[model samples]
Target: MSYFLLFVLAGFIAQLVDGAIGMAYGIINTTLLLSLGIPPVVASASIHVAEVFTTGISGLSHAFFKNIHRQLLIYLAVPGVVGAVTGAFVLAHLSERFAKTCIVIYLTLMGLFILYKAIRMKSTAKAAVTFKKSRIIPLGLLGGFFDVAAGGGWGPIVTPSLIASGIEPRYAVGSTNFAEFFVALFSTIVFILILGISVTSWQIFVGLLVGGAIAAPLSAYVARSIPRKIFTFIIAIAVILLSLRMMVKLIFF
Candidate 1:
């Protein structure tokens, strides 16, 4: 009962951050579950399952707030589903150490890139790097793959890249959160096939689902209401801190 309530709190906090900034729910949830002695693959599987509900609610909230870019959401969703299925298969059969390392490095670099862009967004400089639509396919693929393989990375990989490409922070966040629903659904399906749908603790699932559901609309409101400059800075700092934290955990823990 205590752990269940703790997970409720964890889920609320994780979803709050994820909904507002477009990342970290999986990382946060999975870390807590792992500390409770769940296996890595199972932890990832459980979180993805829980995400099915959270992301769905979150997607609807973003839509309600008019934060999503429809075309961008479509482009991200299809390839992301494909990549997530593939990643789920790979995680079931293979070692993810190398893949996780590469993803962590990529996240760190992207975080820095976003921080630079945030700085530029604050300045009067006309210099900008536009994000080409052509990049969406590959970005979706990679983002989906690493998200499952590393336990949580879709927002970390996709949102900042989109924002750096000069997309508005709100749309990037909203679309990414929306697309993640599909990614999580497909990934959860694949995991259920391979790992059979039982989480280490039912509490983890229910707590996260209920809590995340509660936060979904509120976080979407945050994304919609926050100033672009502040939102961008928050994203930059979140990515940097999350990537660095992942680095430290990977090396020391």
Candidate 2:
């Protein structure tokens, strides 16, 4: 029961950041779950299943804020959805132990990557490189694949990459969050197909829903002046620590 409440709190905090900044939910959830020794595909499947609902709430909120770029959303979503199916299928076939180790490594790297981006976002860095709009799909495909492949990559890859490509921050966040719905939705289907259907746990599913629902509307209405510097730093540290702990266990025992 205590662990369940902690899980709910984790979901609440993860969703709050994700709703506001458009990233971290998947990575954060993945890092924490993996540290607890949950199987990789099971963790990914559970999070994606939860995200199907959370991202929907988030998408509607972003839309209400008028923060989305419709063209970009479509371009990203179409390819992302396709990549998600492929990635989910591939991962579902992996042995649990091997998959768990690989995910810890990948997610640890992403923690550093996200930390760097968070600092950049905090510092008001300007994007010097701008890509043609047509360049969007390629990255979207990769983001989609990695998102399900490692349990989360859509926002971490797409949101900052889009901003770095000279897309506006809010729009990039908004569009990425919007497109993630399809990514999670289709990915969940593929996971169900490959692994067979199981709820994983209703407590977790409901916890995510409750947290995301509370945060989504609040984020959309007041998406400004979040203390990115400190919040993101803490998130970065948490990801690194959790991931490293498991890596050490695998290496030693």
Candidate 3:
């Protein structure tokens, strides 16, 4: 297949998983681009450019479906933008190898915790709990920073953290996904200033944008329709599998 069509397929599949479970869009696409010999900086910049559109559409779709927590979205997004800009600067100056390795390890532990919770919880009881500003603000900052520093960590860090803290899985996924759009946008702008917009290929940018946009609404509906127990299991499995994959790549490749 042509590279354009290849990226379109990658984007569709990645966004389908990402919109439902709240992670992997950037990890998937960036890996694919790198394997095809795109430089790390260019691949990351291109994916973020595409995400500016895909994530916006996905966020809006989640909102229309009543899946988002508006307050949570705001709390995550503002700090997330600040963190993303800082991360972009860091990316230009430092190697991401150590940061990515640390994050993958953390994701593995979180996956296990989520798996334990899925098994032990008897019912899909969602508590109407008020989130503390202290926990969420730090989480947003960390998620945003690693998202740029490690090539996509917002959902991996934020969504599972929210769910582990007793937020409903749907709301956690939706809010995190929405917050990521701002993070991606600001990070892309910083990357452009540092590395130039020409780093990204137009074909990769347009393909990922179109394909992710197509999948966004359908994925939102999937998030809304899935049973809570089943959804939790899916998220747990996805997190574990993706984390393990990253770990293998980090250690072996």
Candidate 4:
């Protein structure tokens, strides 16, 4: 298949999952593109470009029915953007294998954490709760660091963490989507300025935007009524599957 076709397929699949779960576009897209021999930096940059449009569309759709916490967005995005920029540069010089390894390990741990949280939350019959500012900052920092390092793992980490901290699932998802807009914008610009543009990157970007736009409204509808435990379980499963896929590639391929 042509590389363009590959990118389109990757984008479609990634955005479908992303729309349903609140984040996965970068994680899935980057991993697939890297497997196709794309450099980690290029893959990361391309995903960011696509994510800008995807997240914007999804965020707007989510806003129609969800409460977005602007204050939380500001607090989280500041550190996320900084961390993403640093990660993009670091990725530019790292070996793809090493980057993949790091991503696999991180995702695995994060997936397990989310899974555990989901199980605990399920038993309680209430979403986990928290309002501590101290908790938010540190979690945001960690989410930002991983997001940049692994090419957009922040959504999975931040969304669940926020939900666990007592925020409603709909709002947490919306807030994460809102914060992602700036993160992708800043990361894309940095990558473009540093790495130069290419046809492949543009193809992936367009595909992601298109797919995300199509899925956003549908996802918003579902997000409104989906139970917190179910949502957490679904996202956790996705993270675990993606993490395992990455690890398999690292180990045997």
Candidate 5:
């Protein structure tokens, strides 16, 4: 019961960040799960599975608001699923501690990258709407791989990169969230085949589902008011702090 509430809170916060800054749902939620002693593979599988439901709500919310990029969604979905499946399968065979460390490191770097985007990069919003649909193949492949590898990345890697390259925030967030649904759905199937589903914590799964669903519409509402840089900074700080906590625990214990 206590854990259920805890995960609900985690999911709310995770989705808020993802909705606002276009990233961090998987990394944030998985960090909490890992801290609770969940195995690395189990953590990723559970997160990806839970994300399918959450992302569906998010995608719809974004779509209704016309936040998605049609071409970008096309570029991301197919390769994203392929990479997600491969990553899930590979994760199933990895050593827990090693995978945990790698995930934490990956998250830490993502946070820092967010900061770089916020502080260093100039806004390209003037031309952001007509971004060049460049490098979709390699970017989608690698983004999908790292997303499941760390239990999240499609947004962190793809969103800022697209934004920096002149894609607008709403489109980046919406399309990525939309594409994440398919990536998570397919990756979840792969995880079930490779690792089975008996290990997942249903209590936490339900908690995340409900919490994320609640946050979905709220995030879209909040996003309309907040500037993209401000949201990115908030996400960067949250992820950096959580990632440091995970790293500290691993190192000291």
Candidate 6:
């Protein structure tokens, strides 16, 4: 009972963060779950199930308020989906420690990248970098791979890259959320097919759906109204905290 409550509490907090930042739910939730003794693969899989609903609902809401680069989405989606599927398969066979190590490294690097971008954005009033299809493809593939390998936390890895590459912050975040919808869907299917499903997981899934449905619209509103600098700062802080948590667990706990 206590364990279930812990997961529930984690789910609520994760959803709130995710709603506020447009990402980080999985990274935070998986880390918390693993710390609570869930196997890494199971934690990843369970989180994916929750993300399916969260990303789907959030992506849709963002799409309404934000302009999505359909061309970019198309170019990135194929490689991203393929990479996610491949990573899921690889995760099924890999050891938990090995997988966790990879996630820690990715999160640490991603966090630093976001922090740097946030600092740079704050200091500069220059226009964001222009988006190009050539750059989007590679970023999407890399993000998808890490996302799948590390339980769908690829937004931290991808979002900052998009912004750094000159994409507008709002579009970058929206497109990332759009991309995550597919990644989460692919990962959830892989988990269900390869690992089998459980009722407890289903409850988590419902909780994610409920929380996400409520938060997605609110996030879209906030994303549009908030100053770009403030948004970047918030996201940067989230990445830093989440990354530090993962690193600490990897090194000490």
Best lDDT among the predictions, by candidate number? 3
- Per-model C-alpha lDDT, please? 0.84, 0.72, 0.86, 0.72, 0.74, 0.69
Q: Candidate 4 at residue 41, lDDT?
A: 65
- Candidate 5 per-residue C-alpha lDDT over 130-245 given as tens digits, one digit per residue, 9 for 90 to 100: 65446876667767877776555677667665655545566777888888888888877776775565436777788888889989887766655567666556656766776787
How many residue pairs clash in all the candidates, one count each?
0, 0, 0, 3, 0, 1
RMSD of each: 2.6, 4.8, 1.9, 3.6, 3.8, 3.5
Write candidate 2's Cα lDDT for 1-253 as tens digits.
5656656766777777787767788767777777767687666666778888988998898898887778888889999998888777787675545755765675577677757766777455443334565788987887888777765667766765665455556676778888999998888787677668656777667776777777777765544333434445554565566567658866887
Candidate 6 CA-lDDT value: 0.69
In model 4, the runs with Cα more than 4 Å from the true position are: 1-10, 30-45, 93-103, 122-124, 128-130, 163-167, 197-204
What would you estimate as the lDDT of candidate 2?
0.72
> Model 4, range 1-253, lDDT digits (tens) per residue?
8887777778767766676676677767877888889887667667777788888887787778764666676777777777777777776565657656766786788778878877877434764334666767766666666676655567767776676556766777777887778777777777668767443566666765666677777777777768778877887787788778778867898
Compute the lDDT of residue 132 as modeled in candidate 4: 67
For model 1, residues 166-241, the per-residue Cα lDDT tens digits are 7888899999999999999888877777657556657678988988999999999999998777788899899889
Which model scores highest in TM-score?
A: 3
- For model 4, what is the C-alpha lDDT against the true structure? 0.72
> Of models 2 and 6, which has the larger lDDT?
2
Where does model 1 exceed 4 Å of error?
Answer: 34-43, 92-94, 123-131, 194-197
Give the Cα-based TM-score of candidate 4 against the true structure. 0.78
Per-residue lDDT of model 3, residues 1-253, tens digit only: 8888888887888888899999889878877778888788767667878898999999999999998998899999999999988887788676788888888888899989988888887675664447988889989999999988877789998988888787888898899999999998888878777656554478888888888999999999999988777788888888888889888888898
- In model 6, the runs with Cα more than 4 Å from the true position are 1-12, 30-45, 92-110, 120-126, 194-201
Q: How far is candidate 5 from the true structure (C-alpha RMSD, Å)?
A: 3.8
Error of 1 at 171 (Å): 0.4
Candidate 1 matches the true fold with a TM-score of 0.90
The lDDT of model 5 is 0.74
lDDT of 3: 0.86
On the 0 to 100 scale, the lDDT of residue 24 in model 4 is 72
Q: List the residue pairs that clash in candidate 1.
A: none
All candidates' TM-scores?
Answer: 0.90, 0.72, 0.93, 0.78, 0.77, 0.80
